[model samples]
Target: MNTFLFSLKVMGIGLIGIFSVTVVLIIAMVILTRLFPVSAEKQDEESK
Candidate 1:
């Protein structure tokens, strides 16, 4: 029972770490995209 609880705690910590990193990465991607946005005209020109 003690080991089971310990494992659960570790798993919870790992989950939290993964969630935090994912959120950070998503925010970074959003900021980068906003800072250097791709225009529709550029895409249309490239499609030729």
Candidate 2:
């Protein structure tokens, strides 16, 4: 029983760590998107 409980605890901690990393990546993507805005006119000009 004790070993089962320990395994459960380890799994919970691993889930938390994965969740934290996902959140960080999402936040980073949002910040980068805001910093790099795309414009249609800019693309047309660059193509010429």
Model 2 ranges with Cα > 4 A deviation? 40-48
Candidate 1 — number of clashing residue pairs? 0
lDDT of every predicted structure (CA atoms): 0.91, 0.90
1-48, model 1: which lDDT tens digit per residue?
999999999999999999999999999999988876778557777997
| Per-residue accuracy of model 2 over 5-47 as CA lDDT, tens digit each | 9999999999999999999999999998777667755787799
Q: What's each prediction's TM-score?
A: 0.69, 0.67
Q: For residue 8, what is the lDDT in candidate 2?
A: 98
